[model samples]
Target: MTDTALDMSVETGAASYGAASVKDYVALLKPRVMSLVVFSGLAGLIVAPGHLHPVLAAVAILCIAIGAGAAGAINMWYDRDIDAIMARTQKRPLPQGRMDPDEALAFGVFLSVASVVLMGLAVNWVAAALLGLANAFYVFVYTMWLKRRTPQNIVIGGAAGAFPPMIGWAAVTGDVSLASIILFALIFFWTPPHFWALAIFRKVDYSAAGVPMLPVVAGEAETKRQMLWYTLALFPIGVAPYFVGVGGPVYLAGSIILGGLFVLSAIRVLRSEDHKPAKQMFTYSILYLFLMFALLIGERLAA
Candidate 1:
């Protein structure tokens, strides 16, 4: 090859191998999802009976975020085929061919291992184990196995997301407790309604992707009914932190109001014939979880 042609070929190979930009990699991490995971983990750290050094607490949160992102990156890589078929996901790095699949997989695996190892070194093995379990559940259970196979995917898979707070609690206390379990339940019950609301609104995208989302397999009416039941279940679980002594009276009252609104949102979804209610519920669900965790964290800090 001529010198100029050789140089061009090298550049072409580099581009073909891994030309993805920083943002594309960030998309692989699913930063928006990471934010909620981090926040919940922080809440767990803040409310646990023992104090973690601020530096170690920060490390724990970082580990949780990285682990969550690692799972997300692996999920994106695994689902790239379905992602390409779904309009909403079509522009993602893997689906768009902006990133090499092997590179993405390696990035995810590396981050997963690093996050767990660092957590064990910097925090406690209990926290590290939970983080590893969450990552494995998200990747192997939720992404690889459950997601395409069943309508109960999010319901069963939601356990993976619920682990962060428990992990954070263990980072401080070095063991899981009733308070942490209540926190876990809060997120576990919340996940179904939250994702089902999105599924209701994105039925077409899910149906086209050949993913067996509740709405795709069970129908929207059934999905909405299930969402309502989960939201109803969430109300009591949201307030259980208060009963368990992790949350204060302010949290108790706030959770009541928030939980009421959540139920109302589900009711709205049930009554509406259009997607607007589901879309609204989806947006509100994010805010509800955020505020619920914030309330607990704030109340604990104030005490």
Candidate 2:
């Protein structure tokens, strides 16, 4: 669909929204995405070099999840137009006419402010600031600017998702350090290949939505090539925590195995003719990140 058509549909949809249930409001938060964000942030907190009161640690994590969810709500509101046209997003609250766009925006802004303020008060200002920055970047830089305009959207915007670990780390240490930055880089590098795998399989959805995802703009071959490059880079970055002394032997061994599987997944995507491998790669990418962070958390806690 064209931009004009999408806008028109969005306006029409916005005019007739029904009552939103608690479930719809929760859906607006993008819980699946929030889970991963919280998990990664928890890993960062666990692996960091200091101690936080259990209460403060929980508050920090809650803030991270809320900030991420706020960003997601804003993203959905802004992208409601294209979302209505896209198959994957068609059932979203806004596109489905289940919630008001203005309300969604307000809810997001409220949560954003609340999360940052709470984090600053309960945890540390550094983590709060990073949370605020991540939310702003996701909403303003990624959703509003880069997504429709550039194929590099995921590459640059991935930094927003990468912040949780850093935020968690900062929450414990009260500052950003090399270890936190390495955690940030791990997610930053892992994002493109992970997202591009989905894009490869959902090219038609992105194309119809007028989004310039890598596969939609550059074709599957180029997208797969880019995915391979990112995965190769990710391999070393994923295991770097070991050398940096953040992870132990178990983490080292597990990271190597996980990184190898991620590379192999990307290679399969590159060589496959059908969408199955890309879909599998997308699924595996989620597992790869989860396991990588799990190793970090588990190893640290055991120590």
Which predicted model would earn the best TM-score?
1
lDDT of 1 by residue, 1-303 (tens): 698986896677645545689999999999999999999999999989877889999999999999999999999989999999998889899987888999999999999999999999999999999999999999999999999999999999999999989998999999989889999999999999999999888999999899999999999999999999999989999999888888899999999999999999999999999999999999999999999999989988888
Model 1 misplacement above 4 A: 1-14
Worst 10 residues of 1 by lDDT: 10-19
Query: What RMSD, rounded to one decimal, does every model reach?
Result: 2.1, 5.3
Worst 10 residues of 2 by lDDT: 10-19
Candidate 1: Cα lDDT at 95? 82
lDDT for residue 187 in candidate 2, whole number 0-100: 98
lDDT of 2 by residue, 161-261 (tens): 99999999999999999989999999999999999999988899999888999998889999999999999999999889999899999999999999999
The TM-scores of all predictions, comma-separated, are 0.96, 0.95
Estimate the lDDT of model 1.
Answer: 0.93
